[model samples]
Target: MVIVGSTNPAKLEPVRRVFAEVFGGLEVRGVEVPSGVRVQPIGYEETFTGAHNRAKGALRTPGASWGLGLEAGVEFNDLGAWLFNVAVVLREDGRTGVARGGSVLLPPAVGERVRAGEELGPVMDELVGQKDTKKGPGAVGILTLARVERVEFWRHTLELALPPFLRPELYPLE
Candidate 1:
């Protein structure tokens, strides 16, 4: 398994867990990859694009069997606050499968404040009735209180999702 992007421990550890649990016998490794595009706190389209771009790049590397990309960012729905979403994309045999994960919703008022350019932390502090250091840890950060790191979350999502995409013959008729 090739994890496309940074080798930061927080990012890599989750990627490893997904490989171990899902693929069972495959080698899991992390390598820094270039997306050729960077957007701070990525949004939906960019996040997916970034992930796809990374997977393509990782595959070009010598000796790679599979490539994974995890990209997370904030996006606004009709409610208008910056909500969190993560994109996980995998490439093997020149084919790709992608899944997106996110928190259901953030407090609506908080989004309005974020739209005015305040950071998510300050807004979350008010919305959750907490104060200080609220949004500082992990991807899907405040939504999950830093538990299960985003990297791992994305990896697990992709890992569990693959069998269905690859082995549809096993599924019962709809």
Candidate 2:
């Protein structure tokens, strides 16, 4: 069984979906556990910290043969606005694997608003003259979207990260 260090349906659901789709028919189980990490990550290490810590911590728990963690955060850029990236961590034994997805650019106005503590998604919604809608690349936005929702999009994002972590043959979006 692979235990995920997140209880958020937003994070867990996609991890499960993508893993299943990518590794279906394999004897793998997807389970959710609390990550104990904040949602809005602060810095570069924090970007990888929440997810890495969760996976490492989950391994300490009982009944977890494998541990996984997913973390997302916005990084300030010099251009205009910020960029959001998602990190995925998978661990078993002393070996650890990490995977990351492409970034989503946040508009400057929206980025500044979010920097003040407002939620990114909700704030972008208001600015785009919509409500409760995702701005920027959205769930599957900036990357490749196969007509999936935010959760499903996240699922694929993690899925993409997994292969690289698991095999030297796959080096990520290089």
Residue 173 local lDDT, model 1: 32
Q: Model 1: per-residue lDDT, tens digit, 19-74?
A: 67666676666677775555434467876777677777666667677776666556
Off by over 4 Å in 1: 104-136, 147-152, 164-174
- Give me the candidate number with maximum TM-score: 2
Each candidate structure's TM-score, on Cα atoms with residue i matched to residue i, is 0.67, 0.68
Task: Report lDDT (Cα) of residue 105, candidate 2.
Answer: 64
lDDT of 2 by residue, 1-174 (tens): 667776556666666676577666423334454545455665456767777777776666667666777776666757655544454555554555666665656667777876777666666556556554542345344224435456655665576666654585555433
* Stretches of candidate 2 exceeding 4 Å from the true structure: 22-38, 121-148, 164-174
* Residue-level lDDT for 13 in candidate 1: 67
